[model samples]
Target: MGLFQPDTDIFCHRDALREDYQPDEIVGRDEELQQYIAALQPVINGDQPANVFLYGKAGVGKTACTRYLLSELKSDAVEYGVDLTTIRTNCEDLSTSYQVAIQLINDLRGSENRLKPTGYPRRQVNEWLWDELDSIGGTIIIVFDEVDHIEDDSILYQIPRARANGNLKEAKVGIIGISNDFKFRESLSSKVQSSLCEKELQFPAYNANELRTILRQRADTAFYEDVVPREVIAKCAAFGARDAGDARQSLDLLMEAGDIAVEQDADQVTEAHVDEARAALERSRIVDGVAGLTQQGHLVLYALVMLHEEGKTPTRARAIQDRYKIVCDRAAVDSLVPRRMRDHLNELAMLGIASRVERNKGEVGGRYYEYSLDTNPDLLLEALDETVDMVGVTESIRKRRS
Candidate 1:
C-alpha cells in the first residue's frame, strides 16, 4: 500500500451547493464587497434614507453580497438602540403585491419577540402590514431577492413611502431590491424606478484568475489538504471560465470531478477525470433545469426528442400528439390532447427545446406545423434522469453496432 495509491473522493457536505450560497470568507469579491458595505453604511449612521437596488447576471455574487452586508448592518444597528427589523423574501414566491404584503406582515409579527400570526384578512393584509409597521415605531429594511420576478409595482410603491403611507405614522422603511435580471430596474414602473433606484450596486462576473482564487479557497476550506491538487482547482477554474466564468459552475466542476475520481476508485482527480466530470455535471445541470418544469412540458419535450431519436419524429400537432402518448407511456403517464397538449407544446417551444416548423402542402389547415427537439433526446434524458423512461418510451429503439 503506497502513500498515494489514488486520491478518491473524501466527501465534504459543505461543498454541496444550494441555489443560495454565500461566498463570504470563501472567495475574493473585494470590489463587490466594498460597494455593498458602503451602500448599507448609511443605515448604520441613520443617514442613508434611500433604498438600494443591486443587479447582476446569475452566479455573479449579487445576492451573496447583499445578504452579508445586511447581516452586519443589523448587528451594528443593535448598539444604537436602532430597532432594525430585516425581512427577506424571494420575490418569485411573492410575485403579486398581495403576497408581498402578506409575507411582510407575517414576518413583522414574527419578529416582535412574541411570535404572533398576522391573522390579518386577505383583502386587508397590505393595509394591515403598513399599519403594523407604523405601530412598531422604528426602521425596517425589506430585502427582496429575485426582485425582478415581482409581478407588479404595488410593493415597491409601498416600501419606500411606508413612512408617508397614512398608516405609517410610526415606523420608516428602507427597501433593498436584489435581482439577477438587469432589466428589472428599467422595467419597473416609473415611480418604482425613481424610488428604489436611489442607490445601485452592480456585480460583474468573475474572471479566470478570480475563479482560480475562488476554487483554491473552496478547496482549502472544503477538502482535506492535498485531497485535491492545485492543478485540479486550476482545471476546474479554466473549464468554468471558458464556459461562462461562473464561480458556481467552477465549484460544481470541482465537486463533480471529485465524484468521478471516487467512482473510478482513483486516488487523484486528473485532467481526463475532470473532463469526464464536466460532461456529466453539464448534463445533470441541464436535466435538473428541465426537470423543474411541469411534468407535461417535460413529457412533450421528451416525446419530440425521442421521436427525433427514432427518426419517426413527426412535426404536425397530431403527429406530436402521437409521439406525446408514446412519451407518456414511457413516463407511465396518461396522454393529454388539445388544451393540455397545446399548453405543453407552447411551453416546450418557449424553452427552446422543441420548435414548430411550417406544415407541408396538403397538410390540414389551422396552423398544421412540424415540431422538433433542438437536441438529442438521449442527451437530454440523461441530463434530466429521464433515462428511466427510455427503455419503455413507446418507440422501439435499435442499438447501434459497437
Candidate 2:
C-alpha cells in the first residue's frame, strides 16, 4: 500500500527530526538528563552547587546532553529569579589560561572586543574574571567542554578555590567540565579533582538498539510518511555502534542517505540507499578529519596522499620529502625537506592521519622503515579541499594510465 517498499527507493529522506537539522539536540540520555537536572537543582534554587564533570566518547551525547540540559536549566533559573550567569567555552579552542579568561570575560560582559583591552595583560584578565564572578553576587556556572585541553590548571583551581582562599566578595561559583579523555579522570589528584568531580557522569556510547530507538524517534519527526524502512535505521545504528559508536557519524549517514534517495528520484528507501549513505558519510568523515589539520600539517598530508594515489606511496621520509617539495612549490610556500618534514609527519602520525612503520636494513639490521597515510589518499584530499584555503590539486595520482 506504500508508495514504495524498502526496495522502492534505495533510500528515503527520513521525515524524522534530523539532528544536523539544527542546534545539535539530545536524542537519548533520558537518565543522564535527569541526573544532570537533579545535580543542578542546588544552584537552580539559589544554593551554590558543586562542580560537575561529564565525560564520554565522541558522539556519545556528551556535548549534546550537557548543552541541552544547560539550555533548559537557564530558562528555569531565570524564571525563578536566579541571577544565574553561565559561560560555556571549549578548552580545545582556548588552549591557554589567557584565552579561557578572555572568553569568560567576553561572555560575562557580552562584548567579545571588550574581553581585554590593549596591554591589559593576562594577570589582569584573571583578576577581571574573579572580579566579575564576585560582582555577580549570585550563582555563576562556568562549563569548559574538553577541560583536558586546558594546559594551565589555574582556571580550574582559582574559580572553585576562591572561597577557600578567602577571595570571594559575594557571589558563589561552580564549574561543570566536560571531557572525553578516559585517563584524564585519574590524572587529577585530590584538591582540584575533589572540587570538579563533585558530581561525575560518564556518558557511554549508545548500543545498536538504543541508537535504533533514537533514530526512529528522530525519523518519525523528520521524514515524510513511512518513507524510511526500519531496516535502514537499524543499519545506521549497527554501523555507529560498531565503529566507535559515534551518534554524530550515524546522524550524518542518515541525512546523506536521504539526500542520495532524493537525487535518484527513489520513491522508497532500501538497503542500497543505506549503503550509499554509509559511503557518502565515510567520505565526509575523511574530509572533516583532514580539514581540521593545520596548514603545514595539511600540506604534508596532501603530499603523502598524492604520492600514495600514484602508487609511489608508503614512502620513506626522504621520498615523502621529495613529494612534499612539489606540494610546496604548487602552494608557493617555502617548505622543509627531510628532517623538518619528519616532525610534521610525526605530528600527523600522532593525529592518527598518518601511521609509521618500521623496516629492517639487512635481516633485522639497523631499523628504519617508512610512513603511510592511514586514510585513503583521495578521501583525505577531498576532505582537505573543504577546509583548506588554497588547495590546488583536485585529483592526484601516483601512476600514469596505460
Candidate 3:
C-alpha cells in the first residue's frame, strides 16, 4: 500500500463537518431561528426591509444561521412573488467603509466589471453602490459578516439610510450586521446604532446539551455507524461548552478526534482521541496567541508562568510585575512601568491565556486583581521557548521547575 493510501474506514463524508457545509436543519437553534424568521418577515411582505444586527461570540452559529435563513428567505420570496435579493460579504479584512463599499460593488458587478480595491472617493463609491441597488429595483439585504472589523460607522449609517435619503430610488435596502464582538454595537455612533440596530438579535453560546445534539447529528453523517461512539460525542461537547459554548469549536474538536483515530489506525474514535485532540488544539491556540503578543507581553506572561510553577500564583499584580522585571533584566530588556505591565496582563486575560480575579481588602488596600495562567504552564513554556529572546527565560524557568 502507498503511504497515502485512502482510508475509508473512519469518515464516510468528512466534509459534512466542515465550516462551509450547511446542515439541512440547524439542529440546536430553534428559538433563534423563529426569531430570525420573524425578523425577515418584512422581505416576504413586500414592505421595507428590516435592518438587523446579530451579535455573538465566535462559532456560536452567527454566520451559519444567516446563510441558512437567507437561503430559505430567497426560496419563499420566489414563491410569494416578493422581489428579494441578498448579498453577503465577510468584513474581517475590510477595515474601512471604502473597502467594504468596493467589495460590495465588486460582488454585485462580478469579475468582468469589478472595480479596483483602491483609488476612489468615498462619495463616488456610495453613489455607485446606490446606483447598483436602484438598478436591482427591489428589496435588498446586505449581510456583513464580521462587520465589527470595519473601523468606522460610515458604511453602516450610509447603506441602511440609502433609500430613505433618496440615494436609492427603486431598491429598499436593509443591513444585516453580524459581529462576534459584544461591544461593537455600543462602540458605534448613536445615529449608526439607531439605524443599524433596528432589529437586533442575539445568538447565545450553545449549552452542552445543544452541542451534543449538533455533534451527534454531524457524526451520523460524517462517519459510519458506530465509528464515533456516544462517549466521544459527549466528551467533545463537554470540552466545547467548557471552552465557550462554540458550535464551531465543538465540530472542529469532533473532526480532529476522527483525524487522530485515523492516524492511529483505530477502529473507532474514543474519548482518549478526544482528549489528545483538545490538547493539540489548545497548544496551537496558545502558540498563535503568544505569537501575537509584544516582547513585554511575552515577559509578563513568562513571569506569570514562572510564578505559577513556583506556586506563588493567584498572586497579585505587584508580585508578577516584580518577577517580570527580573525576567526583563535577565534578558537585558528594559522593564515597563507597573501600569503598562498591568495592561499586558489584562490583554493576556482577554486572550484566555491568563485568568484574573478581583480582590477587595475592605477599602484599606482597596480593589486589586490577582492573576494566574489559565492555560497549561508546560504548553505556555513551550510557546515562550519558541518566541524570540524568551528562550533563555523559558529554559531557566524549566530548569527551576524540574
Candidate 4:
C-alpha cells in the first residue's frame, strides 16, 4: 500500500470554500443586490454614477457582492457601448490619502509612469490621480475596500467631487467605499460624508438557515458527492450563527472539518469531525489573538488569567493593575501605571479576550467597572506559554495556587 490512499481525497475545488472566492451567483442577498444595482444603474444610463457606501460587520457579503456586481456591471457596460473603467484597491494596507492616491495613479497609469509611494505632496498626488482619471476619459468607478483604514479623509472628498470641482474634465468619477467599521462615516469630515454617503447600504449578518443554504451551494463545488452530510452542514451553520452569523466562519468550519476527516483517513466528514474542527479553530484563534498583542498586552492578559485562576475575577481595575505589576516583575519587565493598565484592560475587552461589567457601591461608593476573562483561562495560558517565555509567570501562578 502507498503512504496515502488515492480514494481518501475529499475536496474537489477547495478554493470555492475560501473567503475570497466569488460565487457565480450570490445567495440570500437579493434585497442588498437590488439596492446596489439601482445605485449603479445611472452608469448604464450614461449619467454620473452615484458614490455608494457599504457598511456591515465582517464576513457578511459586503466585498463578495460588490465584486460580483462590479464584474457584471463591467460586462453590461460593454454591451451598452459605454466606456467604463473600474479600479479597485483595498485601503487596509494603504493608510494615508497620499498612499491611496499613489496606488490609484500606478494602477491607472501602468508601471512605466508609476509614482513612488512617498516623496510627493498631497496636492501633487491629487493632481496625478485626476490626470489619470482624465486620461481614462469615461465613467470611472473607484472602489476603496476597507475604506476605514485610510487615515486621511481628503481623498474621500477629492474623488467624489472631482467632476464638480473641475479636477476631471473628461472622466466622471464615482467612489464605492466599503467598510466594516460603522463609525467610519461619522469620523469623516462633514464635507466628505455628504459626498460618500449619498447612497448607503447595510449588509446584515447571515442567519443560520441562510448560512446553511450558502454552505450547501459551496459544498457542491468544493467537495465530492456524499462526502459532507446534511447534518454536518447544519451543525456548522448553527455554530456560525451562535458566534456572529458569519458565513466565512461557517465555510471555514466546513472546509476544516473536511481536512480533518482526510487527515484521519476517514471516508466522509461527519458531526464528530465538525466538532473537532471547531475545537481546532477555536484554539488557533486564541493563539493567534494572543500572539498579535503587544508585550505589555501579553503581560496584562497573563495577569488577568492568573487572577482568574485564583478566583479573583470580576475584580476591579486596581486589582488587575496590582496583579499585572507582579506579572511584569516575574517577567523582568517594567510595569505600566494603573491608568495605563486600565487602557490595556480595555483593549483586551475590545478583543473579546476579556470583558467588563459595571456595578454601583451605593451613593457613597459610586460606580466602577469589574473585568474578567471572556475566554477559557486554561486555553489562554496555553497560548501565552507558547507565545512567550512564561516560565516565571507560570511558576508564580502555581505559587499563588499553592
Q: Each model's TM-score?
A: 0.71, 0.71, 0.91, 0.91
Clashing pairs in 4: none
lDDT of 2 at 133: 78
Model 1: clashing residue pairs?
6-267, 7-267, 7-268, 287-383, 315-370, 315-371
User: Which of the two, 1 or 2, has more lDDT?
Assistant: 2
Instruction: List ranges where model 1 is wrong by over 4 Å.
Output: 1-26, 79-81, 111-123, 262-266, 289-378, 381-402
The 10 consecutive residues of candidate 1 with the worst lDDT sum are: 393-402
Order candidates by lDDT, high to low: 3, 4, 2, 1
Per-residue lDDT over 215-248 for candidate 2, one digit per residue giving the tens place of the 0 to 100 score = 7776765567677789999998899898768777
Better of 1 and 3 by TM-score: 3
lDDT value for model 1 = 0.71
Over the stretch 336-382, how does candidate 3's per-residue lDDT look in tens digits? 99999999999999889999999999868899899988998888878
**What is candidate 1's lDDT per residue for 1-402, written digit by digit as tens?**
776543325555444344465545635688877766776777777753568888877766776666777777788899876777778888787677767777677677775543233454655776777677777766778888888877887778777876665657667678888887777787888888888988888877788899888777666656655678778888888887776567877887787777777777776667887889877875665676577677677677666765686677556767778767876776677888666897888766655556767664664554566777764466675555653444344334334311
* lDDT tens per residue, model 4, 1-402: 887655436988889999989999999899999999999999999999999999998898999999999999999999999899999999989998888889998988776877877998778788888888898888999999999999989889988888898888999889999999988988999998899999999999999999999999999999889999899999999999988888999999999999999889788899999999998988888888888899999889888887888888889999988888887887788999888889989988877789999999999999999999998766776787787675367656667767
Which regions in candidate 2 have their CA more than 4 angstroms from the true location? 1-27, 75-82, 186-190, 287-402
lDDT of every model, 2 decimals: 0.71, 0.76, 0.90, 0.89
Looking at candidate 3, the ten consecutive residues that score lowest on lDDT are 389-398
